[model samples]
Target: MVPKGDLAAVLASLLPAPGSGGLVGADALRCARALGVDGVAVSVTVGSGLNELLWSTPGVSTQLEDLQFTLGEGPGPEVAASGTAVSVPDLVREPVDRWPVLLPEALALGIRAVFCLPLLAGSACLGTMTLQRARPGPLEEMPLADAWIVTHALTAALVQDAGQWAAFAAAEDGSDFYRAAVHQATGMISVQAGVSLAEALIRLRAHAFRHGRPLNEVAEDVVARRVHFRHDDGDGRAPLAGGGTEGP
Candidate 1:
């Protein structure tokens, strides 16, 4: 059995650097792994669609969850939408089909169990924190408690960082990584498509999901002018106008 003090210690270790930003994704994933969870993923809803903040210690098919965002279905999306924690102790044994597309894909990828917790600050839902275990078994209560501690820690960190983006050096440290570009691209797509930022982001995720590609890669294409969105297409496709195909 895990001890509450041990969980508290784990959370203590997650404290963000003073005058630095929030905790890093890798750090959070590592912490979850240390607590003995199978996998951890951080997802946030930007505009209408959700984006992956981090997938900690994922399996070979880490991209599967991303597919859910693109397809607009899955445990992560459900948690984000409901602003409540959703736990599927055994994915294969679940009675109802929460995510028809994602469930089958997860089962195929050897992910037998899962737990998803919404990342929220008061009433504002920031995203979801998911844990996946390969074997089927109930999670120890202590671990669940620890998970909540971590989730609240993250929430606090996010709130702190938002008010002070420069508090963390990483926030100031800029990179051309796809995740950052994706945010920029989302803003651009929103303007170009004349759609709400959320809707534009959802469209971006749909395209990424349908094509079996990383959202970051899709965002890169958008930034490079290799891809563009057409609001006229109800199916969320890029028009073949500039050498880009019309499928996600």
Candidate 2:
């Protein structure tokens, strides 16, 4: 078990630097490892069922975020949407109905346990901090408490520093911090299908799921005119031209 004193110190030291913006990925990874989790990430909701991944540990953690964004399911999105924490001690033991698609895929990716804590600004949920473990189990009491501390600190940083962290993150490693393509495609689909932006996004996810492609790739295709959505298209599902769904 991690000592609360050590956790407190680590969190204090890693609090978002006003000059450098929010907590850096390295510091986040260090804090997550110290808390005995394999990976962790922070994200904010951009729109209905859309999130902007701010920072995350490398490897499967990053993949998990992408998967959740693509499938529009999982504890991370749940917490971001509802502003309530969602803890899955063991994915295998979880009811398939809870996340019918995300469970099998996440298990295949070696994620055994997951936890999501909301970052709240007053009564509003700004986003969430998602943690993943390779082994199946719940966090110890100390670690769980420390995780909440991390969320509170992150929330404070995001609220106080405003756009500094987001801007800094956008410049790091050429990451698409804002998920521009997803947003762009949603808008296009909204117009093409004559549907609300929320419905357009739902159609985008369904199309991605049907084609077994990543959501962003499909969005990129739509933005590139490789995929077209029409009001008459059944359920707004259309196959990519040339039997492919990737953008050129």
lDDT of each: 0.66, 0.77
How well is each residue in 1-248 modelled by candidate 1, as lDDT tens digits?
A: 55455455556565545543334433645666655676776666664654655434555235555556556777888888889888777888876466777787778767787788888888988888787777877677878887887788777766665534443324465321226777787888877777777767777777776676777788888888778774564664344221223445
Consecutive 10-residue window with the lowest summed lDDT within model 2: 239-248
Q: On residues 1-248, what C-alpha lDDT tens digit does candidate 2 reach at each position?
A: 55465466666565445454434323667777877899898888876677888778877787788789878889988887788899999999999999999999899989999988998889899898899999999989988988888888777766675466566556664434446787799899888867788777778877877776777778888989888776553544343321223333
Could you tell me every candidate's TM-score relative to the true structure?
Answer: 0.70, 0.74
Candidate 1 has its poorest 10 consecutive residues by lDDT at 236-245
In model 1, the clashing pairs are 19-167, 20-167, 20-168, 21-168, 47-198, 48-198
